[model samples]
Target: MAQLGSDLDATRAWSKARWRSELRAARRGVPASVRFAEAMALSNQLTSGRIVRPGQTLCGYVPVGSEPGSAQMLDDVADFGVRVLLPVVAGRGPLDWAWYAGPDSLRPGPYGLLEPIGERLSTTALRIADLVLVPALGVDRTGVRLGQGAGHYDQSLPLTAPGTPLVAVIRDQELVPELPAEPHDVRVTAVITPHRGLIRFD
Candidate 1:
């Protein structure tokens, strides 16, 4: 029985890897002009949709590489009168948090990501977020978020308050009907896509 369980885990991981590579290729195929426009659209929607109220803290991140949204989008979230806490990759465990001061405050961190220069908060600090914006490769209509496969958000999201929205940010095409799932996967409550805006699931 244990061997069977291990085999299933290996198969699921392979499926997720294939999906990740395919989605990455799709993102890379997008024209630079269109990508920029989509990023702007995402920023407009997230800030205007009132996901985070004034004075509330938002657990968010700075989009890197071919990811949806941009660093400016994070700034826009901050400008919406909410405090933004960007993740700091710590080893291979759950992520840490830090206040996003501005463009000047970001310093390079682990996993080739940018992190804030402010005081690093522990994983439990996620409970302070009114809304959590998680990065993903794609998300199914069922809210099974296909992340970058690093499992960072997987470990980090459980620290949030039960009622806080665990939202996935992706491009319009990345929202699919279904994706491979594992028991440990943290499903998102909602998804934000460029043209699709924000779509919620039960």
Candidate 2:
């Protein structure tokens, strides 16, 4: 039984790795102009929709490369008087949080990410967020998210208060019917795309 479990774990890891590589390559193939436009549309949806409210402590991220949305989303959310918290990658452990002051408040971090510049908030800080906009390569109707294989968000998501909305940010095409899911995989509550806006699973 233990050997079978170990084999299953290896298979899942291999499947996840393939999905990450394929999705990332597809994202990178997108035109920059299209990406920008889609990002703007997504931002509009987030702001116009009731997903995030004013004065809410929302946790968001700065998109890198062809990832859906843009830094503008973070700024736009902040403009709504929402206190935005961006992730700060600390080694391979759970992510640390920090307030997003503005674009100027960000500095380049490891893994080609833009992290917030401020005192590191405890991992428990995620519990204070009214909503979380998580970065993902793909998400299924079942709310299974395909991250970049870093497990950063996976490690941090458990810290959020129960029932807190964890929204996955991905492109419209990336919203598929299914993806490989493991016990440790954190399912998203909703998915946001340029075309679909926000689709809630539960």
TM-score of each: 0.91, 0.91
Candidate 2 local lDDT, 1-202, one digit each (tens): 1121124454344466676776777788889899989989998888884788887899999999888888988888888778999999988989999999998999999889999999989888999999999999888778999898888899999999999999999888887666789899999999989998889995
- Residue 23 alpha-carbon offset, candidate 1, angstroms: 0.1
TM-score of 2: 0.91
Per-residue C-alpha lDDT of model 1 across residues 1-202, encoded as one tens digit per residue: 1121124354344477777877888888889899899999998887785566768888989988899899999888888888999999888899999899999999888767899999988989999999999999988778999888888899999999988999999987777666799999999999988988888999
Clash counts for the predictions, in order: 0, 0
Cα lDDT for residue 52, model 2? 86
Worst 10 residues of 1 by lDDT: 1-10
* Each model's lDDT: 0.85, 0.85
Q: Which regions of candidate 1 fall more than 4 Å away from where they truly are?
A: 1-14
